[model samples]
Structure formats: C-alpha cells, structure tokens
Target: MRKKGAYQQYKDVQIKTANQGKLLLMLYQGCIKFLGLAIKCINDKDFEGANNYLQRARKVINELMSSLNMQQGGEIAENLAMLYEYMNHQLIQANIHKDTEKIKFVKKLLLQLLEAWQEIINGSNTEENIDTNLSINI
Candidate 1:
C-alpha cells in the first residue's frame, strides 16, 4: 500500500489525540464543508457531485447523532437527535432535487451549532472543575 500523505498523517494524529469536545467540533466542521461543496456542485449543474457531497454530509450527521450520550445528555441529546434527523431528511431532498437553497439552510444550521460547540469547549477548558479529557461522548 502507498504511504499516507503528510496532511493525512497529520489528520490521523489530530483525530487520535483530540478530546471528545474537539472531535465533536471536527464533525460539525466536516459536515458544514460537505454541505458547502454540495451547494457549489448544485450551482455548477453537477448533480452527481452534489449527491456525493450531500451523502458525505449525511454520514457526518449520522455519526454525530450516534455519538450523543443520551443517558447523560438528557433533553439536549434528544433535541440534537431530532435536529440531526431533520437535517438528514433535508439533505436527501436537496440531493434529489439539486436544491442549493436547502443545502444552504443546513449549512447555516451547522455553522450555528459549530459556533456554540466552540464556545462550550472553550469555556469548559477555562474552568478547572471541568476535565478536558473527559468523554462527553458527543
């Protein structure tokens, strides 16, 4: 097998070493990226490319939903699971119809969630009571 590229190796290390909070942020960023790419593909009339990107975004959302710690997260996890399901459905419709607007809406929601996650992670890091390494499982 061919050796991994430098960037690939770096990403591997990053993922391996990241705390649960960081991993969650990475998932959100990745989903937003895929959604943006899908929008661009739709604008360029590349339905196949759009479908591929939307599928990738859906996978990320699924991963996020699966990672949630429902027992500990309580109502928050339940709400997030519902939202993720909605986003996945929107992505499916967007892929079928080649709808840039729907993709844009999903991207907007992801961005908002990313910002909130970032703040939560940052705030938690600043507090000594919170363990950065603790698995929130999100």
Candidate 2:
C-alpha cells in the first residue's frame, strides 16, 4: 500500500480504539479545523477549495447532530441539535457568499463547545483517577 493509505489506516485504527467521548471531541475538532481551512481558502480567493472545506465541516456537524441521543441527553441534546442546525445554515450562507467572517464565527462557536466537552471529559478522568487511588477496607 501507498504511504497515504498506510497513514489513513493508522488513523482509522486510532479512532476505532477511542471511546465515544473522544470520538465526539474529534468531531468537534475536525469541524473547527475544516472551518479554519475554509477561511484561509477564502482569503486566498480559492472559493472552490473553501466550499469543499465548508462542506466537509457541514458533514461533521451533521454527524454530531445525528449522534445526539435526545431521549437520554434531554435538554442538552436538544440545545446541541439547534446549535448544529444553526451552524449548518451559517455554513450554507457562507458558501454562497464566500464569507470568511461567517466561517470565523462558526469556528469560534465550535471551539467554545469543544472546550466545554473537553472540560467534562477531563473532569471525569480526574474523578476516576481519584477513585482508583482511594482505599476501602472492610
């Protein structure tokens, strides 16, 4: 296999080994990365490239929306669904207008959301570590 094919396989295996929380984190980060790339493409007058990146970002947002478990997640899931929908609409407008500012706005929102998720995951890890270090004697 080619070098790119090997790298892709490695990435797939890494993702497969990650838990759901990490997968969600990766999706948010991927969306932000694509949005940033689209912004740069727009700055360089590469509308076609910008549109491609924006479309990729939209796909990530769609995946995030679809992964939400409304019944179990409650208000949080509903709010995330609305945010994802709004981001998709903004991306559509950005693609149509070739607006770099809108892409920046959306990237900022994704970064903020990603940070929130990171905190939750980090806190969970800390709690787990603390529990593991504790000793209970009967």
Candidate 3:
C-alpha cells in the first residue's frame, strides 16, 4: 500500500477536527462526488467502475440514514430517512441495469440535498457571526 500523501493527511485532520454539522456536510459532499463519478464511469462504458462508485455512494447514504436522530430530530429525520431510502433504491436499480440515466437522476437528487445542507451551514455561520457581534448592554 502507498503511504498517505500530504493532501490525504490534511483531509484526515480536517475531518477529525470538524464539528458534527460539518461532518454531515462532508458526507453529503462525498455522496455527490461518488455519484458524479459513477455517472462518468457509465458514460465511459465502465460498468464495473460505475458499480463500485454507486455502492460507495449507497454506503454514504446508509451512514446518513443510520446517523439520523429520530428521537430528537423527529419529522425532519424521518423525512430524510425516507429520501435516503429512495436514493438507495434508485442506486440499486441503476447498478443492476447499468443505466446512465438513472445514475444522472440520482446524482441530481443528491446534488439538491447537498445544496440544501450547504445553505443550512451558511445560515448557521451567519447566525453565529450575529451572536458574536451582539454585546450585552446593561
């Protein structure tokens, strides 16, 4: 096996230091990356490579689903779980049929989810900035 490169080491440290919300965003980004690769592999007539990428994407979706806090997150968690399930089903069908169209559709769905997560991250950062700027005027 090859030794870890500098970039890989840096990414590891970044992930280790990231908060939960950032970690969640990373997972979504991973899903989008894998799905995009899977689509490209299909376009290249590399069904095997596509299958591997799709399976990796499915694993990320499963992780996201399993990490949901149903007890605390309630309806939002449940909704996300359902969406993840649908994506997994779509991925399985794409893998079995080696369909580029299905892969594109799933990629689109994942991209939408990633965008929403990014917006949420940005919104929280804005709120944090506002909180830090406020002074307790007695």
Candidate 4:
C-alpha cells in the first residue's frame, strides 16, 4: 500500500535530483570553457588573462565539488580531487617562476580533461572523441 503523500514527496525528489544533475553538467562545462580560455591566454603570453581565467576555473571546480556527495562519488571524484590539487600547485609554480612553459604544461593537462568531458557530453563512449591538442586556430 503506497501513501499518497509519500508518492508526491518521491516525485518532488525526482525533479530536484534531475535539476541537480543539470546544474552539475553546467558547472563542468563552465570549467572547461574557462580552461580553454586560460590556455589561449597562456599561448598568447597574456599572463593577466590567464590568471583571470584560472580564477574562473577555480570557482567552477568549487561549484562542482559542492554538488557532489563525496562518499558516493567514488574513484572518479577521488581522481578529480587529486588533479585539482595538482592543477593548483602548477598554477602557483607558474606564478612563482613566471614560467610560460609551466603554464603550457598545465594547460595541456586541462585541455585533455575538457576534451574528455566534451566527449562524454556528446554521448561518446570514450575520451578519444576530441583531439586534446591545444593549438590555436586563430
């Protein structure tokens, strides 16, 4: 026997869950967009632009993390957490050394991540759907 109120509550929960998933997807895509811009800035030797993009990227990562239930997110989440830390470290080192190469290396890694995400978003079964190269067309 199903209670009427319980069924309504369950329906509400389903809608909320769907909305949350959409929000997560948006956040991930936002991160990738900012990361792509950051790569462009690096390649163009625009340190200020690159730094601004990094701030945006950090915000996106924070939003993505807030959307997750840590314990339930499993290995992918764990790997992302670690990669985020590495990305932060690389950014700091680039700032300290004023090293364009460091920024390039970091941007390459981020590009790979973004391209992989795009592949998944496009319903590709693997990350190979997009070339991970960072060359600028313009």
Candidate 5:
C-alpha cells in the first residue's frame, strides 16, 4: 500500500483527537460540502459527478442516523432519525434526476443542524453539558 500523505495523516490525528460534538460537526460540514459540490456538478451538467457527491452525502446522513441513541434521546432522536431518512431520500432523488433544488434543500437542513450543534458545543463549559446536548451516542 502507498504511504499516507501529510494531510491525510493530519486528518486522521484530528479525527482521533476530536470530541463527539466536534465529530458531529465535521460530519455535517462534510455532508454540506458534498452537497454543494453536487450542486455545482449539476449546474455543469455533470450527472456522474453529481451522483457521486450525492451518494457521499447520503452516507454521511446514514452515519448520523446510526449514531442516534433512541433509548436515551427519546422523542428528539426519533425525530432526527426521521429527518435524516427524509434527507437521504431527497439525496437519492436529486442524484437520479440531477436536481440541484433538492440538493440545496438538504444542504440547508444540514447547515441549520450544524449551526445548532455549534451553538450547543460552544455554549457548554463542561463535558456533561455537551453530552446532554447531543442526542446521539458518542
């Protein structure tokens, strides 16, 4: 196997060191980035590229959904899981149809979630508070 590049190694270390809240934030950001790329590809009439990016975003949503702790999170986790499912469906439709509007809708939802998470993580002075804010399992 080829050796990892400096940036890849750095990213690995960063992920290993990050807190749960930070990891969640990263996932949201990554999904948003992929969706943005998909939008650009759609605008350029690159259906293959858009499909690839949409698939990546869907995977991130899957990860987020899997991380949710229904037992501990109650109604909130259930709602989030449903929302994630809807987002994934939207992504699939966007991919199949090369629909930039659907991608934008999903990206908007992710941005809103990301902003809420940032507020929760930033406002917390204690790890316990962070844990409380996060409906998903660490």
Candidate 6:
C-alpha cells in the first residue's frame, strides 16, 4: 500500500513475466523440434518416427492448452483454438493413411505458425528492457 514499497513489487512482477516468457519459448521450441522430427520421419518414410513425433507433439500441446480459458473472452485463445483444430485434422489425416506427403504439408503449416509466434517471442526481449514493470501471462 505504501509508494516506497512498490519497487519490490515491480521487481517481483518482472521476474514472473520473464519466467512465463521462458516457458513459452520452451513450448515453441518443443513444437519446432516435433515438427522437424515429423518432417524428417516423413521424408525418410519412417512411419514409426512420425508416430513418435506426433505423440511428443501431443505432450507439448497439452502444456499450451492449459493457458486457454474457453469460458472467458480472449483473442489469443480463439486464434490458438482455430490453429489447434486445423492441426488436429491434418495430423489425424496424415496418420490414418500413413501418408508422408500429407505429413509434410502439415509440417509446413506448423512452420508458418512457429514463424509467426517467433515474432511475438522475440518481441518480448525488447519489451522487457523498456517495460520492466509490465507483466504478460500466456
């Protein structure tokens, strides 16, 4: 409640924000790796590796889903939901037919998603410097 004590509060918030950003970076990295592995497996015609990547991706996705709150309003939530739906469909179709081409297509789509997300992720670095007191949770 005191103005002089606000500095510690501000520092705490910055640390928390940094931690969340790191978590997101980890998520994105995981997705990228899964997609890479899937693409590799597809190119090599390794159905087993492709399946393994899909399972790993599912685990990464589960962590990201925890941030979604369907009962509340969120622009990010809506966008991610749409992406998830599309990704799910593509992944299932690829798996069903054991199709390498289809898996490659889906991997491309995921790459685009990662590139877009990277902009925001990298932007966080710049943001942290100018707005140390700001907090963003994703």
Top candidate on TM-score is 5
lDDT by residue (17-128, candidate 5, tens digit) is 9888899999999999999999999999888888888889999999999999898889999999999999999888888888789889999999999999999999988877
Number of the top candidate by lDDT? Answer: 5
TM-score of each: 0.91, 0.86, 0.86, 0.52, 0.96, 0.62
The worst-scoring run of ten residues by lDDT in candidate 6 lies at 129-138
Query: Candidate 4: lDDT over CA atoms?
Result: 0.60
Residue range with the least summed lDDT across 10 consecutive positions in model 5: 129-138
Give the candidates in order of lDDT, highest first: 5, 1, 2, 3, 6, 4
Model 4, 1-138: lDDT tens digits are: 966698889866755764332334455566667767776887798878888877787776665445444465566666777776777677677655556666567667766766675455455333232112211110
Quote the RMSD, in angstroms, for model 1. Answer: 2.5
Clashing residue pairs in candidate 4 (N, C-alpha, C atoms within 3 angstroms): none
Cα misplacement distance, residue 84 of candidate 2 (Å): 0.6
Residue-pair clashes per prediction, in order, are 0, 0, 0, 0, 0, 0
Residues 1-138, model 3: lDDT tens digits: 999999999999999997666777788889889988998998899988999999999999998888776765667777888988998999999999988788788778878877876666667765444222221110
The candidate with the higher lDDT, 2 or 5, is 5
After the best TM-score superposition of candidate 2, give how far the Cα of residue 90 lies from its true spot, in angstroms.
0.4
Deviating ranges (above 4 Å) for candidate 1: 126-138
CA RMSD (A), model 2: 7.0
Query: What C-alpha lDDT, on a 0 to 100 scale, does residue 77 get in candidate 6?
Result: 69
Instruction: List candidate 5 stretches off by more than 4 Å.
Output: none
Q: Residue pairs in steric clash, candidate 1?
A: none
Those runs of model 6 whose alpha carbons end farther than 4 Å from true positions after fitting are 1-18, 69-73, 125-138
